[model samples]
Target: MKQIIKIIGNPKIFVYTLIWLMVLVVLGTLAQRDIGLYASQQKYFSANITWLGNIIPAPGGRITMVVILVNLTFMVLFKHNLWKIKKIGVLIMHIGGLLLLIGGGLTAIFSSEGNMVIEEGAQSNYVDDYHNMELAVINTSNEALDEYTVFDQPILGKGNILSHENLNFNIEIMSYLKNCEPLKRTAPAGIQYRGMLKNFMLSELKPEKENSRNRPGITYRITNSGSSIDGIYGIFFGQSVSQTAVINNQNYEFIIRKKRTYLPFAIELLDFKKVLHAGTGIAKSYSSEVNLIENGIPRRVLIEMNEPLRHKGYTFFQASFIEGLEGETTVLAAVKNYGRLFPYISSIIMSIGLLLHLLSSLPKLLRKIPGVSPS
Candidate 1:
């Protein structure tokens, strides 16, 4: 046991381990699942934890495990004499590689992403739209209370109960779909009316037009008193509560669907400016001027595709453009994570490792020169 520890603890062995670690990380990244091809690095980790039976399934576990195993195996089996100055540079290279691995791991565990869409003249304090599905409750009576909020992840969909005491409700999400247009079902007409019906209520039949039916929300029933309310509606966007229940003389609203990923502040699209490369008409740069309202204060900001504006824990980027009466207007975003900094840090470390490894071999080449003294 001590011999194994001594081998790994050795500086020479450590450097070789880092070399293999770099190779493994590269291989792992390339060997990820097909879904990972277009997804960000953060998506890899979430996918890993989503599968059943294994901690990480086929490709994710295979790649990560191989990396760790190869790194350890190299440290144990290899013997490198790094006591000389030539070896010091090599050691620096390994240290940089270690930082890269650590940075990538941190990024995988802690990063999240979603989009924010804002229209002209519209002021919103919360995220206006999202691709993810969630369940939230709002008690208009108690404005101060958060009521109940539930997010449906892979694990949560597998039958985990979410409860809130303030509003006295328990929820279980049966299924959810986002960024999709689904085949809507029709409500039965045979049953007698049990509650108040409003004229502005949505049609019982699914709308025929798909273009106008862009956002698709979740449909989950509720356990009301004795008989279950099996057919409840949760419209697209946020707060899709179509039913009102009276509990202790107060009306409580139950929402089970998707909510728009929102920011603390409001972003209004003012105008968009586009510059194209001359002659060829290739795009050079595009930017948006936006009006941000936060805490009753409005500030004008500029956001470009790559050059996003970050304010109050949100990042605003120019996602899309609309040709309106004001020439053109762009979609200014409010992103949760400003820039993906962890991967950049990892890139820097990897670069340092490469530079040091190159420097370490220089002395050996110099010593090989004819008539050169050992000193």
Candidate 2:
């Protein structure tokens, strides 16, 4: 036990760990060129273990940083004489570093990132996750309101069956494709798909390197009382497929779309303006004018590229714009981070610590010079 502690508390081990972290950063940056940003981050930074070309083992960014944090903690508490007056600056610096590590860990675990798309003159209270998807079974019997049962992406796969107590029918996943294209239905069809899919066939395509660009398609069968009612219904995002199945005498609509997170307030888009540079297609600036409605109260606000709106622990930044047939749509990137202020706070603390250390060491540094003398 003491041997392990001694090794961990060694200053050389901490330096070695930092060197390894630098190597990981360089490798991860180069990996983005081949696998893209999202895939590179997942493989090299967020994961616990990573492989080089599916064979060589490497310690991931998360594990390396965690080990560095532990090493810093051990050095600060057990190895360094932190109580000495001369070590005050060192102590403060270590404390700041510890806070930064804690903040990073919190951000990694508790942060939420999503996007909201609001068309001109339309109001939206929900944000969609960029990469994650869900299967939505909506009860649209009542024209006034629609109740939705959403199943997240975890349990979606071939041969998987999902059921709920309130639902009298079972959903059997027949096929799932990460990327697919709709083609005109031709001859040599094995089983006919219902509704919009009847006229078109879903052809599986290779997934894009950028995962956000990939559109998913799912084919599911609805069975009730040991009988198939909806025969191989297919759904995909960005498709205008309107099909309903009657289960327990209730009409239900099914679709596969991006996962949504409903916010406490709604945002109504009033205007979206984009300015382009002279004689160039590059956009100079883009802004969105919107009204935030909450609890029957509405407040008009403008969001721009660098300027973001922070409300109720969430920050909204104007990301991009999309043109549609009806009108232009504004895309806002929403981020909810619990440790948003940690980096700023830790930076201040570290700066103060560094200043103090420099001040304390000035006399020693001056004594080493022949022409310079300390007062």
Candidate 3:
């Protein structure tokens, strides 16, 4: 245990770790050109271990940061004489750094980020994840409301069978594609697929590194009592209507789409305005006027670039706008980070500590100067 502690506290080890982190940063930046920002981040920073070009193994951002945190903690607790008055500022600075590490860990585990896209005059109470997808089965027997059950993407694939208590039939996955396009039906006669999919075929496309640009497609069969009921149903993102299946005389709808997170309150898009640069098509700025409706009351709010709206622990920033058939659609970048303010708070603490340390050493520094005498 003593040897382990000494090794962890060694200055050489700490320096090497920092150098490795810098190398990772350089590699990650270069990788973004080929894999894009989101993929590079997942591969280099978010992962626990990463292989350089699928060969050499290296510690990832999370692992490197964790080791640094341990080294800092060991130095502060056992190596430094923190109780001494002269060392108080050094102790505080270490504490601030520790807080930053804690905040990063919290963000990695708990933060949620998604997007809310609302057309003009439309309201939404949910945000859709950019990369993750869900398989949703909705009960549409009632004309008033629909009950939905969603399954995360991890459990879906070819040959996987999923059954739910509320569902009268079991869903068996036939085929899954990360990126695909709908094609005109060209299969031979006596084919079994039904509904709109019968007229359109699913054509596989090259998957994009940016997951949001990829259209995922799934072909599934519904089986009841060991008998195939719905031949084969194809569903994909952006499908106007979900494929419907009738089992045991009950109406059910199935769809695969970006996962959604429901918000406590709904936001209604009142208006969206975009200003263009003079004599050019480039956008100068864009903003959204929204009505935040909560508990039967509505509050008007404006969200603009660099200015975000915060309510109920969620922050919504005006990210972009799209032109749709209905009009302009506003896309709000929604982020729910519990440790969002930790970095700012830690930075303030670190700055104060650094100033105090400088002040404490000023007298000693001045006395060492030639012709300078202590007061």
Per-model TM-score, in order, reads 0.63, 0.90, 0.91
Sort by TM-score, best first. Answer: 3, 2, 1
lDDT of 1 by residue, 94-160 (tens): 5555555555554445434555545555555565434344555666666676454445444345245
Query: For candidate 1, what is the lDDT?
Result: 0.52
Report the error of model 1 at residue 18, Å.
11
Flag clash pairs in model 3.
none
Clashes of 1: 2
Candidate 3 local lDDT, residue 23: 90
State the lDDT of candidate 3 residue by residue for 331-351, as single tens digits: 999999988999999999899
lDDT ranking from best candidate downward: 3, 2, 1
Output the TM-score of candidate 3: 0.91
- Residue-by-residue lDDT tens digits, candidate 2, 89-145: 888898899899989988987888999999999999998988889998898888999
